[model samples]
Target: MTRIFIQDKATFKTTARTYDDAGFLHVPGRVSKTGTQQYLRRELGLDGDPNARVTVYRPPEEVFAADSLASFDGADVTVMHPGELVNAKNYRKTSVGLIRGPGQQDGDFVKADLVVKDADAIAAIEKRGFVELSAGYTAEYEHSPGTTDDGTEYEYVQRGIRINHAALLPAGAARAGRQARLYDHQPKGSTMSKITLDSGRSVEVQDEATAALVQDHIDRLQKQVTDAQAELDKRQATIDGQAEQITKLQAATADDQITARLKAVTDARARAEKIAPGVTFDSIDPVEIQRQALAKARPSTDWAAKSEAYVQAAFDMAFDQVETTDAHADQKRKLAEDGAKVVTDKAKMPAYDSYTARFTQPQAKE
Candidate 1:
C-alpha cells in the first residue's frame, strides 16, 4: 500500500496563550478528531481514476492510540504544508515552530502544545492571520468498507499514523478535522465531483451535498410525470364509460321510435279497412292512405285542392253516413218480417203494415 499524506485542521484555546521575551508564542489546542472524512480519490494519490471520491474512517482507537499521539511530540510546525513530508532536509526552511509537549487524547480529539518560534509566525497569529492548524501526517491506508457509530460510511481506514508536521493555516481553510486526509499538493478543484447532465454534458459539483440536491430534483419530477399519467388514464376511463351509456340510450330511443311508428301505421290501416273494406294498405305511407280515403268519400269535389284537415273531415262524415244507412235498413227489414207474420195470423193484433209505416221514416240524401 502506498503511504498517503493527510491534513486535518485544528481548533485552539487562543485565550490560553503565552509569549516569551524571545518572541516565541505557545498555544495549547485540540488538533484532530475521530470520525469519518470524505476526500476525492486524487487527493490521496492512490492508483485509480482521480475524479471519484472516498470516505475514510479514523476510529477512536487509532486517533487516541499511545503510539500515534507520541509521534506528534517535537513535530515540525510550518506556516502551511510544504507539499511534502517534513524531514531533516527541509526542516530548517519549513519549520516556524514545533509541537512542544507530548500529544494526548482529549475527549474526541488529540491535544498538544504548539509553539511558534518565528517572529513572523507569531505576528501572523497575533493579527488573527493564522487562525487554524492543519496536521500533516503519513499513514497506511487499509482499503475496506465500514460504518461509524453514527452511521457514517467509509471506504478506507487510516492505519499506522505517523505525524510529520503541523501547519498553521488561515481561517476557514478546513471546516472539519476529520481523518480522511487531503493531499495539500492537489488543486482546489479536487474537492469537486463530476456530474453528468441529461444533455450528455457534465458539471462539477462540490462533493456529495450538491449531488444529492440534484438527485432529489430529478426524483420529484419523475413522480410528477407518473401522477400526470395516472390522472389521464382515469379521465379516459370515465369518458369511455359515458360513451357506452350514450350508445345504450341511443339504441333504446331507436326501439321506442320504431314501436311508435308501427302503432301509427296499424291504426291508419284499421281506419282504411272500415272506410273501404277488402282494400290492402300494407307497405303504404299513412298520409297516402288518408288521401285515397278522402277521394272515395267525396267523389265530385276536387279533393286534390283541399287541405289535409278538410279531407279528414269529409272522410269522417262519409263514415257516419254509412253507419246511419245500415242501421235504418236493418230496422225496415225487421218491420217487413213482422207485417208478414201478422198477415198469416188469423188473430190480427194491429196490422203489421200500418204499424211499420207509423214507426219507420223515409231515408235522407247524403
Candidate 2:
C-alpha cells in the first residue's frame, strides 16, 4: 500500500458544518502542494487514463454491505495522543458519507459528513480541539526528471496512481502534516525534508526541525550498535583467558608426570644397588624395567616354563658358590658329594644310555 499525505491548514475546522441537512466534519481531502502533487501523480493517479478514476472509500471493517458499489455504515474513528498513533485509544464509530467535491481533480477537496450516531463522540472530538485524516492506497508510477526552485535536479512521478481507501483520523497531526512538510513545493526556511527516489538518489528537502529529528534517530541507532560490539569483545576476551588457563594447566600436568617418572627411576636404582653389592646397574632405565616386568608377567608359550626353571637352577648354583667361604667348608664339601652321587645315579638310569661322562678328575693346586 502507498501512503499519501494531504494537509489542509485552511480546513482544520472542528465545528460541525451543515451540508444537505447532515452534520459534516469537512476536511481538505487534497492540496496542491509539491508533496500532494507527487502523491497524486505517484500514489493516486490524477495523470492516468481518462476513463479510470480514483475513489476515496471507507475501510473493509466499516463496510456493512457490499454492492457493485460498496456501502459503508460509518468510518473508523479514534482519538490519538499528539505526535504518535501508538497511544491512540478511546474509540467510537460514527457513520460518515464521503463527498467528492466538484472538478474531481488533483487539487480538489473531498469532504466527510459525520452521521452523528454518538453524541459522546462529537463531544470528545470538540474536546480534543485538533484532528487529521489518513488515506491508504495502492498504485504504480514512473519517475521523471524535475528541478526545484533553486534548479536542483530531482525525480517526480510521471503517471498512473490509484487510491484504495481514506479514513478520517483524529490526532494524526504528527504523521500527516509533518510528512506533508517534507514534500512541500516551497518549504519555509525552517522546514526539513528528505526524499529518496527509485534511482538510488537521495535529496534532503528538510527544515531545521526535521533535520534534528533525523539526526536524533541516527544517533540512537549508532549507540545501540556500539554497545553490542563492546559486549561481543568482552565475551571474546573471557574465552581467550579461559583458553590460556587450560594451556598452562596442561603444561603443569606434563611436568608433574616427568618428575614422577624420574623419581621412580632413582628409587629403583637405589634398591638394586642395596640388593646387589659391588654390582653397578648403570644401564637400568625405570621405564625399560617396568616394560620387561610386564612382558615377563604376560602369558607365553609352553617353552617359557622350562626356560624359567633352567634360569632358576643356574641362579641357585651361582648363589651357593658365591656364598660359600672357609666358615662353611664342611657344608660345601657335603653338598658337593651329594650332587656327585645324584649325577652318577642319574647316568645309570634308562634315559642315560646315550650320555657319556667327559669330566676329568680334580687336580690338586699346591
Residue ranges of candidate 1 with Cα displaced over 4 Å? 11-16, 175-366
Pick out the ten consecutive residues of candidate 1 with the lowest summed lDDT: 178-187
Worst 10-residue lDDT window for candidate 2 reads 64-73
TM for every model, in the order presented, reads 0.47, 0.26
Q: Identify the candidate with maximal lDDT.
A: 1
- Candidate 1 lDDT, tens digit per residue, 1-366? 878888777533123367788868877766777777667788788668788878888888888888999999999889988998898898889999889767777666677787889988877776866757788998878889988775557899988888888888776655343221211222333455555555667787764434534643454465557868999999999999999999987885797877987887777677766677766543556666766765565557777787878777776676677678878999999999999987678345567666676669675779
RMSD of each: 26.3, 21.1
**Candidate 2: pairs in clash:** 45-161, 191-206, 191-207, 192-206, 192-207, 193-205, 193-206
Taking the tens digit of each residue's C-alpha lDDT, what string does model 2 give over 1-366? Answer: 333433222113233233243444433333111222212332343566645423232222112112201211133323322221111252323223332422122222323332333445445556764334443322233344555443334444422222223434444343323322112233223443464433456668545435434543454456557868999999999999999999987885797877986887776555433333344443456534333332333325232344544544443443445456433987888999999999899878864654443233455689
Number of backbone clashes in candidate 2: 7
RMSD of 1: 26.3
